[model samples]
Target chain A: MKGMTIIVQTITRLVKIFILLYGLYLTLTGHLTPGGGFAGGVVIACLYILLTLAYGRQWALRRFPRRLAGSLDSVGGFIFLIVACLGFGFGGMFFVNFLERFFPGRPFALLSAGTIPLNNIAICLKVAASLFLVFIVMAGARLLEKKDRTYDYKQEEEE
Target chain B: MIQLLPLFVAIPLGAAFLTALAAFKARRLADVGSALATGALLVLAVITIGRQGVYPVGGFLAPLGITLVLDGFSVLLLLIVNGIGFLATLYSISYMERYTSKYKYFTLFLLMIGGMNGVVITGDVFNLFVFLEIASIASYALVAFGGEHEELEASFKYLVLGSVGSGFILLAIALVYGATGQLNMAGIAMALAGTDKHLLIAFASVLFLAGFSVKAALVPFHPWLPDAHPSAPAPISAMLSGVLIKALGVYALARIIFNVLGATPLFGMIVMGLGVLSMTVGVILAVGQWDFKRLLAYHSISQMGYVVLGIGLGMFILASGGDSVVAGTALLGGILHLANHAAFKSLLFFCAGSVEFRTGTRMLKELGGIQEKMPVTRLTCTVASLSIAGIPPLNGFWSKLIIVIATIQAAFTYPGLLVLTAVTVLVSFVTLVSFLKVLRYVFLGALPDAFRKIKESPFFMGVTIVSLALLCAGMGLLLVPAARGAILDPAIEALKQGLGYGSRVLAGM
Candidate 1:
């Protein structure tokens, strides 16, 4: 797929960093605010989608490959499940808030709620990677279909 | 045993992702990891047969924190889900070779297992819905795994209808919460006990029935199962018909209605009506089908009707203040038939899959006697067929007999029940006739020239299916009082308590 116009590309290049930063901000401060991992993850995915739109598919894929995104998706899920299983170590319960129970992060701070922040971060990685992957795969299919149609039209004209 | 309740969900989920991550390097890891995970679950379910516990997740008490209940009811369901899950995984090792992306298949399979486990063990209403979606979404993906035009179309139909069902369930949960201010099943039971929100409760009850009926594929809501079950791979077909429908649809509805809302005559009547309709309609549809998998799928609907009928009869009896013994008898029949159906139906699907695996076709018209070549499959398929037809000395006959006897016992109290007994017998006869057709066409006819070169399925698939056939034969031994007290009775007791379940759970905690 080809890149967009120079004007659009320039704006996306300028705006991408800020959007990524905002996504991180949302994820890290999820416990203190309304936005959490899922919200932040979507925002981050949007930034990559913007990059894909502004630059070409090849450029975007070179920066963040499908293999890397897929692995990251699994990694995020592992982190989440491991966090839940870790609760079994601190307490017999499957998802007990063991950190808050013993370590007791300060209230109204970034580390409060013990495992909730970690969970949010894990969820953020998962959502962002999965969403980006979904976008690219779907776009690839659409592009393939379009190519097939054009090739068929060329054949018809030749006939 | 109670403390480890979460592992039922955890183990399968962890294996799913683990399979995905590792299979990128070693393509075979998906097979071993998934089988080990489901095997672990089956072992866990086995050891916890008679045990019951209320686990408060995050160490929060009930009515406040999410609870996982491992009562007799859920334990039985856990056994069926993970037990069949282990076998399905084993079967898929050889069976899934025709499909690419083996890891993706295992991943979705494990996710479906985890989701079904969660649905069974959860005591919270909203949590049930979440797990229901998890299982449903995984299944929808698996149905379309083939990526063919027909597969995709069937999957789309399944998805749209499934989402509508989920919407109704969510709306009902909201209504119940609004009325009782409780999301926990027991808490709802307690809060709703004395309340006069009759209309609200009635409306919510109807919504739950409609939603769960759709999931269970009760007649009016059953259009998707025929398409979705057949289009998927054979192992997946077994799972969908064998345990998935029972866990997500019948078991979920049974839990919510009898335990949370308590049994009422009207609820009983409506459920039984749906059951009877599904029975007749499903078999009637099956009688005309030529596709092997499609025929079994229709039989699944019909057999599920038998289960629902028994349970509904129990609910009706208890609600109307009838004899306790009759209610227990009816319930025993229903729940036992569920387990029996799980074994035989999955075995039947496996046999059909084996036929397709060897012959490269599933249509009855395209299949004929290869029985001499595929002796093990022919034998196991015959066993499963007889068991499903309610022939003597097998599990199916015992449960059907119990249901018929219970109906007769109840008929003295309400003469209308005899009519039900007649219908039950008639449906059983129809089931036999259809199986006879399957046997006559596929196994007894002259060997088709096309299948002369065909052979028995792989050793693993044969072993997996034979184990299920063994279960179909030996499950009748569960009727012995000592064994019954351990597994089946507790499940029956769990439902028998009805609204009293609230106090029992809270006190147990």
Candidate 2:
């Protein structure tokens, strides 16, 4: 219930940053490539899940606490909404590509698609936080506690 | 004004997160922010009356990009969903103080409201499914918010059945996409219009009907509703029964059948059949229930039957080339009943919630004589009870009368339809009897010694219930010529247009 062996912890410490970096890369380049916010976010969340498995709840919570994760999720959702609503202030309707004329960057570049890359970033933040929250909520319980697994049923009898 | 259409969905969604973040610091922000958000949406919906337009999301033209349409049907539903939503949020201001995690509750509540708005306005069928899931998932979580054994069990049942329904809906969407190669509603209608009635389309239609039946809690797919509705927090119970079922289930069904697939005589008959079954069966089961909320939940099923029957009769008449005036009358009755039910049903649930809040019990057998203590609740509950029982001059009466008259008129052309007239009356009478039981058991009779100290519900709760009660008493004005022209008639006309909706939408684009 504490954690894994030192070897697994050492390996996770080395690989976690790279995995997070790769997820960010995928999200930033999503407009031009296949792996977008959702896929990239899941990949980023996997890094934390790996940390939890290797180093236990104490170490993982130290890095990404519950409140931080919750805030990140809300912030991401709000940012996405603001970006969508931003188009309304311009000449075009809601969610319009008002940035297209200003940016007008080269095609297929990282910043070529107006508002898409920003949206992808927002979604990446949201999806990553949400996946981590789900894992934490599930694993906060004693995963190996056979008693905890049957906890819900026992409560039913009490009712 | 058309440009503001997307704000209907975006505002609440944005506020959901804002509340989530802000409430972590202040806590009170959640209450103020949610009420303001829903109140803004209500104002927006009112402004939309008698006006119609479409806004393509991201400025992408229809058939290529997602569009938000604000036609009469969408407007009607927006009013019901947002109007009740605002009241529910206000009621929750006082009601939710007893419950922990108030911020989280408001967050999910706003999300549900946003999702329902998105479902109403979206012009694409696939987009409809996505918003439906959003609303459904939010509801599933809210149902289990209490985390009690009963709440968890009810939530699990709802989640499982709801997921199956969503799966069916997704499969049907795939079939429709494969058949028509169109994701937008107008495009799909146009494609389906030219093609013959193929087995693939019929299969998809069947899937849609079955799926929406689950969402609407129709007879065969209704097992989850009774358990889920009563177990949630009372404001949520009001939301679920009042607007969620109508928005996600019946409205979606009507849009698909009338606008996209175009209702044929056979489909109309099948819809009418389902309506009759729910009406008879829902009341029959409801009559035997002692739980106050459960009885109301069953009555939800039964009242939905009236709405569906009215619309279905109109659809049948339209498809069968019967009198156009009669068809319009039937559709009017159905759509009007839909609005009336939203006000009165939520009011009833609010009353139940207030009673439960004060006395800590919803068991009809144990409670009594609280009417002397909570006069506001007693008065509002009586108004709602009268409305639902189809008392004249109240809103429910006018709609029920229109439906009955339509059924009798249709009987001249089709004799079997006469039976539905009698059935509708019988169902109304049975409903009156059920409410009479609720009144006698909960508000009347000797006062239990345990409840003598209870007070009237808090101010916010009383304001909500009273406003809704006033709406219940005054909503018959919607039938007046001036109001009907602006509100009910437009929606009825939209449904009556049927497959022609495709061309109109295309023209708007």
TM-score of chain A of each: 0.86, 0.85
- Can you list each candidate's DockQ? 0.50, 0.70
Candidate 2 stretches greater than 4 Å from native = A105-108, A142-159
- Candidate 1: what lDDT? 0.91
Worst 10 residues of 1 chain B by lDDT: B190-199
Off by over 4 Å in 1: A101-107, A142-159
* Residue B174 alpha-carbon offset, candidate 2, angstroms: 0.6
Residue A56 lDDT in candidate 2: 86
TM-score of 1: 0.96
Residue B289, candidate 2: how far off, in angstroms?
1.0
Summarize candidate 1's per-residue lDDT along B23-135 as a digit string, tens digits: 96788888889888999999999998999989988888888889998999999999999999999999999999998889999999999999999999999999999999999
Q: How many angstroms is residue B304 displaced in model 1 relative to the true structure, after the best TM-score fit?
A: 0.8
**Would you estimate the TM-scores of all the predictions?**
0.96, 0.97
Taken over the whole model, the C-alpha lDDT of each candidate is 0.91, 0.91
